[model samples]
Target: MRCCLARRRAANSPQKTQVSLPEMKEQLSQLIQQALDALAADGRLPEATQPTIVIERTRDASHGDLASNVALTLAKAAGYKPRDLAGMICDALPASPLVSRTEVAGPGFINFFLSGDSSRAVVQRVLTEGEQFGRSNAGAGRRVQVEFVSANPTGPLHVGHGRGAAVGDSICRLLSATGWSVASEFYYNDAGAQISNLALSVQARCRGLGPDDAQWPEDGYRGDYIADVATAYLAGEKIDATDRHVAGKADPDDLDAIRDFAVAYLRREQDLDLKAFAVHFDRYFLESSLYESGEVEATVARLVANGHTYEQDGALWLRTTAFGDDKDRVMRKREGGYTYFLPDVAYHFNKWQRGFERVINEQGADHHSTVTRVRAGLQALQADIPQGWPDYVLHQMVTVMRDGSEVKLSKRAGSYVTLRDLIDEVGCDATRYFLVARAPSSQLTFDIDLALSQSNDNPVYYIQYAHARACSVRAKLAEQGWDWEQARGIAALPRLEEEQEKALIKRLDQYPEVVAGAALASEPHTVANYLRELAAEFHSYYNAHKLLVDDGELRDARIALSEAVRQVVANGLWLLGVNAPEAM
Candidate 1:
């Protein structure tokens, strides 16, 4: 087992600047490389026996602060047993202030036990960095376009759309924090059979025909919101959506005018729904624009020119199997109208041409079939696009539960729960947190009762309350006629000797790594999970300790720790697009 002793620093004295976890990891990696170089120079190991060193925090405190498997990784390469190699590497390692000691454990794992001061310095670092604490420049400001919540403007957004908006927007925030220049785009499927059905439904409603009426279109939408749209249209309401403005014609007989009006009306409704949910898109690219600009046709011609397309049974098909699709897919139908996937291919091709080297599509898992077809279409174009050109984050279904049963129907939508319904019931913070608190690929169960709870059962509430508790400490200090000295608290950091204090500092140190990893993996849930865990740690520590103590040095140190906790909770919640309230 590895153990480290606290190195006492002058209480209430000025200290040097703090190093972040990534910087410390890099420094440790350099030290290991130095050891490798020494081994090479001593002729015990081959020259340039350098491997990419991976340093990870030890889950168990007994194992040490950080660990590496470099020895086990390079053991075979050096013709030495793993344990023997670890000992040799340890012997060769130079002195460093960051690591107090090194240990060769089972399977040749090299564990570095950090000095107590180094471990506790995270509190000072968190205080110094504040809101910018967890952010990093890992992306190097690369341009990344994230397309999400492109719900067809046929009806109001449903619960599934809520998940996509929350997850997708959080992803953009994550990428931006990691230094990526993120562009959030929403692709409007505004020119398809679905939109045609929406127009027919609205026109039928305008003609005083209901779903039960025999004159209703077979594929007409049955949502009560459709009736609302028709009412607004008959009123000649001038509706302005993000992309266009349409004055309702008030002509029940004009199908063309009704189509335009209905699309605009529903698009505006979707805009309101997303706005109420606190989601925004940088651009709304319309599917009709693709057809109007002839990109769809141009894409089809290119596929044919590349010989990746064929004509059979009076339809044009792309040999999607050439790019790993299960089979070929139809590009244009027998009646000359293109299929939905063709428009998708054109849209992505436009994305590539616009200089978006990285494009991520966040959509429902129901679009799984399109992933292969879309990629295959991109490949068949003979474009320089990679095999998996545009990436996709497909989220599974969301089931909203209330009072022990599934809440399936919404009065406005008349079919499924609307995103606005959830937002109105629980407010935006709880809704956003619940929607994104799980991995995208996992099925999520949103519990309305739990989200509204004031106890720890509510994750959003619990996390926010921790921040609130930390904030209350300062208020209490003020109430007691005591002021906190930040420099004194940092200098007195060595006074925080409790296991809980140590644990909280260690957790705070892991934030930047968590943010970078979550951004890279396109997993916002990782940050959500970390916030919950960190909140739990803070709550436990706060419960066991008192910040407004009589001892000035100890009080300052505890206040500093609490403030650090507050800063980190705020930072993590900000990344998830959720708020961390100073008071519950």
Candidate 2:
């Protein structure tokens, strides 16, 4: 366990420098295409033929840095064997300082060995960008919005909602790091029938002291927080007039009473819990607010103009099928009330109105049926909504377990484990990490025992330990007369050359790649897995060698290596909303 947490640094490390080259990979890809074009241009190949370069990692280190297969593609058209085509392409390659050597081997595969300068430059890039390395300008400063964990205000967030929170939050963080301006949103379900019932539930509970088995609505909330919310609502507020207790009486504004009760009750409770769980939002978009703003009316009218909606049976229906939905969907039911889908489309239109180039809705598992029509409606009204409107992400369920048994989690209308409950048990860092530790599409089983455990066996603890170890190493260095800010007088890291040291260095070099891959995939779990792997590498290095050595140069070099490690671990954990503590 101790070994898993140790973070060994290298002193007398290489001098850091920045690499500002623009689109090196893209340029390399284009050059490979040129090589294929050369085969055709030289009349040594067939007419107008183009075979793509397939560059990727090599299994054998001796093969080179990156391998490509442009030759195999040119073989058929050139009427020559693959190896012969590879030879021609290699001979015609342009000179580059980035590539020290290029060799053709194994069925016409072209392997290029990157110059040591490029590899060394990667270290500097890590130092310069800190945690923001590998972030892309692909977004080109596009404004984006992410709406997530909008679980109705009727109850506390359950286990499943935790997954959406982590996924959505991490996606927002990744996008912002990559040059996209991002806003995190929560769509409040504060104006629905279910919420109305919640107000009445509290009203009923307020009239009584304890659980009333006789009058308790079966479909209403039964969570402990329900009682808690009820208490908060009753505190210091007078309830003198009682129509229900009288002989068959009614409050004139009964529906309004219920609506008012639900909204306030949920807002207070959710606020308390959201803060406790550290699931924050920049804005809480209310469905009622959209309705009040006439955005819904505007959306419906625009849909009609687009010929996507028609009146039938005194109810408005959107021709979603025309936009690829299986069937036309009702905007308002025959009962003269809007279907759930109506406001949903209106919400997305509002997202577009806010000038977002892309909108991502991180929805729960249950909303599978609703995603299609909302997208279809947007496509139907593309003239009104900006192009490339929105993308929907449906995450699967999360199961909470303890001691190998499924914890009882019955959302009985509004009864279940709140986000706060999980936080109280495992803490915010553990909760966030556990939420994103699995694939979003795969049903996740969160082991309460594992997350809350102090043992390094827990991946979160292991990562945190690496961060803490880095800080400790730095503190000791500070006790001596060294600071990471001072440039290394030595040309480069020397004598930190054991396998373990190199292993840790390699891990540090790959941070940008890991971050870039995670953002592209829209999978934050990749970051979590990366931190764990990196921690293991650093730990192994620390345990095998003594960084605080008798030799000053080697000691300084080791500390420099550890300083780089600390920066990365701290940055990665910060992106995930996990702390990198100086001391455990």
Cα-based TM-score, every candidate? 0.93, 0.85
Weakest lDDT window of 10 consecutive positions for candidate 1: 1-10
* lDDT for model 2: 0.72
Model 2 steric clash total: 15
| lDDT score of residue 141 within candidate 2 | 89
lDDT (10s digit) by residue, model 2, range 1-584: 34212212222223322433334555567777776677668877676765555677565566876778877876786788999888888887887766888999888899887665455454445565666666767677899899998877777667777788888988888878777888899887666777767766766666663344778765666665566555555453332211111111123235455445446556655666666666678887888887899987888888888777888998899998887689899998888878878888888877777888788888877888787788888888765554335777778977788999988665432445557678878998999998887778888888999998999679998998988887887787778776554244122354456656655655676677777777767888888888998899888888877776656657766776776787888888877878788989
Candidate of highest lDDT = 1
The per-model lDDT (C-alpha) reads 0.89, 0.72
Runs off by more than 4 Å, candidate 2: 1-50, 58-63, 87-96, 103-108, 209-212, 237-261, 310-314, 382-388, 410-414, 480-486, 494-503
